[model samples]
Target: MEISRKNRRLIHTIVFLVLPLTAFILFVGFPLYWIFITAFKPESEISSRNVSYWPREFTFANFGEAWKNAGFSIYFKNSLVMTLIGIVLILVVSIMTGYVLARYKFKGKSIVYLILLCTQFIPGAMLLTPMFIMFSRFHLLNNVVALALINTTFQIPFNSILMSGFISGIDYGIEEAAQIDGCSRVGAIVRVILPLLKPGMVTVAAYGFIACWNEFLFAFMFTTKQASYTLSVGLKSLIGEYAMNYGQLAAGAVMAVIPVTILFINMQKHLIAGIGAGAVKG
Candidate 1:
């Protein structure tokens, strides 16, 4: 009877969960798997009607060719530099702003909060024209600094919200206790409150990193100089106006996806805990 009950529960669980699991496998898992396979396939096999579930013909040369021929090395370096710089700036600015919002009672605090929330309603595309003109006038186009600055601006409001929620969850008495122990206000934040904010910080950092990493429209619009091209822009070039090289395109796509995947995998536990904590506290 116990075994039958356990089997019945299992069947009900599968009935509810299996459809979503199957959809995820088909849409998310299979695409990643196909990219991995395609990254190693030859040019002919990639374009051919005969699709091998696994590569009947495999070549490491696709990656080598992509690395050398697609200008990915330079693109990868530019992407890394821009993403890192943007994330650092966003984190520093948002953390301080979030802390202030969470802890301080000031005039117009409600107005400030409302303004921050309202900014989220604006589409990123709406800022493009004004930003482009501003950057162009300043001759900042085609620079990684331009990309970093633009991305940071958009990231700050959202990140500040996430951080503020997390900061609010921590008791103000903690900072008060630290102050009583000879910590200055800044010192209390840096030495005590900041330490407690780590999980939320990690969560925001991952968000900022992925946002900058996969960002294309701004990168494409802002960067025209060959040296400034990020992986997304470089990947676009793999598809000519007329002809697309499927193999190299797939290889570049895989390259772009791999780093982010590995990063998430390594930080999976921290990310989950951080998100969960932030959500609960918020």
Candidate 2:
């Protein structure tokens, strides 16, 4: 007996796709699984050289300790507020800049873009000294407002460049037609352009939030006060001279990952819709 064509194809598919998919899943999911399980494990289990896949003992004390003793509660609130503020500013500025870059031609436009691109390659650590000095001079140190402003400044260049490409995908004829139908320039942009730009905006907003949320260097450097420290900074503070609490750290990480995961799941629908809409329009 010989294998049928269908059976051969099925074997090939399994070899080419299913095996790789399973491997990839295990590789990617293992760290997340380990961290999540570790968050529930007792300190003794976490420290032992003989590590088990399952927790020997589970406790909620880690989360409570993280929230209270580690100052994650304050850090979480500060991170949320700061990230939101940065995202808003980035969105507002990027939209206008992207629209202009996409729809208009002006002197130094290419040069401006080149500068923005170049700025992305510069080491943020290298800028720390000047930035700290500048902040100190302006009394902006240890301030969430200053942190938001710094995040916005660094984020805007890349985001605006990306949004310009997104804006270019939109048909300008719609805006022109709206203007012809008694819509003012501002109104045309507000009504026609902004609606079309929602997907790009959402995408950029998510990116901005993640960037600001994970940003440790600037946040660590600028925020000296516990009340102003972001989650990343606060997590770094969890490491002590003599004692390290792995469970509390893992719990804090899990807590931080949850909101971003929820947000991504929610926006995934819009991202799919955006792809479909683009395909239709194209």
Candidate 3:
């Protein structure tokens, strides 16, 4: 009877834990595996009727062609500039907004919070035409600054709310103590509360960075010039009028993914830790 009980327990463990893990590994790993294999596959193998799971002719030639002919170097620099600028602006603005919302009690605060929540539901597609028109009126079309501003506007509300939660997690007394030591409100935040919010800040910054880096719709709409094209836009350009360059497309994807993947893995620990500490008092 005890042996039978152990058998049932083992079955439960496999069903609850092992099966899901195995499934996750396959789902996530398969795409990366596919891209990696396809990136190395020669054009003949890719376009052939018989598609092999592995590449027949693995080549470094694809990477060279992607960097040069695909204009990925230009795309890489543009993406880096836009992402960095947008993320910096987002964090700076979100942190301040979050601090005010979390630490202070004021009139209309709940209304402001509700409005922010509402913005989340507004589809990006809906905003595209209006935003394009607005930017065009200002003659900001095809500008990196315009793209960065648009990305930051779309990103800020959520990151601000997130930052508020991080701020709320810390005790108010710490800031008060800093105040007692002759620090101004700004100084207290910079010296005291900001340090404690590092984990949350990292999470927020990562979210903003990733969003801006991978954003295609706004990037595509805002910039018509190839010089201003981001990685996503550049990658999209790889799709031809007649025949696509799948190998170069895959190589560009792999190249585009490398920096963001490295950043995410490095900061994922902080991200998880920050998330575990919720913003709402409840």
Candidate 4:
């Protein structure tokens, strides 16, 4: 009787937990596996009516084609430059805004918070027309710097609030102690608070990097020239009106995934900690 009951419980656990987890893993993992294989499969294997689980012949032609012929090299460079610029702008502004909100009391603070919260609800599409006109008037269309600025504009409010929460979690006494020890306000922040805020900084940077890197609609709409196109826009270019290059598309996707994946892997620990701390204090 005892052995039967233990067996039943074990069966229940497997049914309720193990089965669902395995299914979910397959559901997500299979597509990634398919794409990885498809990227290496030759052009003939890709367009065939017959589907194979594995590539019969693997080749590097897709990556070469995408990089050189498809102009992804230019797109990749543009994305790198724009993302780096946007991340720097985001970090600087969000940190300062967060520090103020967390450490100082000021008039209109509630109103500012309310405004920031409201901006999150505003859809990106709604601002597209106005931004286009504004950028056109300034002759900033097709410019990477302008793209970075727009990305920074959209990213700031949420990041500021997130940074504020992180700052709130830190004890004010630390900054005070630094000030008492002959450091100026900026000096204390530079020398003391920033080191302690590494986790929050990593969290913000990861979010900012993803946002800037994956931005598509803005990059597509604002930049008409191929030279200014980011990776997301470049990926869309692989689809023709009458034909699409599946292999190149898959190769481009793999390239796009690599950087963000590496970043997340390296910063996973700090990101988890920062999010948890911010959530509790926020």
* Winning model by lDDT: 4
Candidate 2 structure quality by residue, lDDT tens digits, 165-246:
7899998899899999999988999999888888789988987887888889999999888888898888888775359889
Q: Name the regions of candidate 2 deviating beyond 4 angstroms.
A: 1-11, 268-282
Candidate 3 pairs with clashing backbones:
165-279
In model 1, the Cα lDDT at residue 177 comes to 96
Pick the winner on lDDT between candidates 3 and 4: 4
Identify the superior model by lDDT, candidate 1 or candidate 4.
Answer: 4
- Residue 244, candidate 1: Cα error in Å is 1.9
Worst 10 residues of 3 by lDDT: 273-282
lDDT of 3 by residue, 129-219 (tens): 9988998999998788788988999888888888888898899999999999999999999999878988778898898888899999998
Q: Model 3: residues >4 Å from true position, as ranges?
A: 1-20, 272-282
Top candidate, metric TM-score: 4
Q: Rank candidates by TM-score, best first.
A: 4, 3, 1, 2
Model 4: worst 10 consecutive residues (lDDT sum)? 273-282
Indicate the residue-level lDDT of 127 in model 1.
84
Across 1-282, the per-residue lDDT of candidate 1 in tens digits comes to 256988988888888898778888899789789989998889889889988889988888777777887788889999999999999998999898898898889999888778877777788888888989999999999899889998898888878878887899899998999999999999999998888988778888898898899888889889878788999999987876367777878888888999899889988986676567545533
**lDDT of every model, 2 decimals:** 0.86, 0.87, 0.87, 0.89
- Report residue 138 deviation for candidate 3 (angstroms): 1.7
Task: Using lDDT as the measure, name the better of candidate 2 and candidate 4.
Answer: 4
What is the lDDT ranking, best to worst?
4, 3, 2, 1
Better of 1 and 2 by lDDT: 2
Question: Candidate 4 deviates by what RMSD?
Answer: 2.1
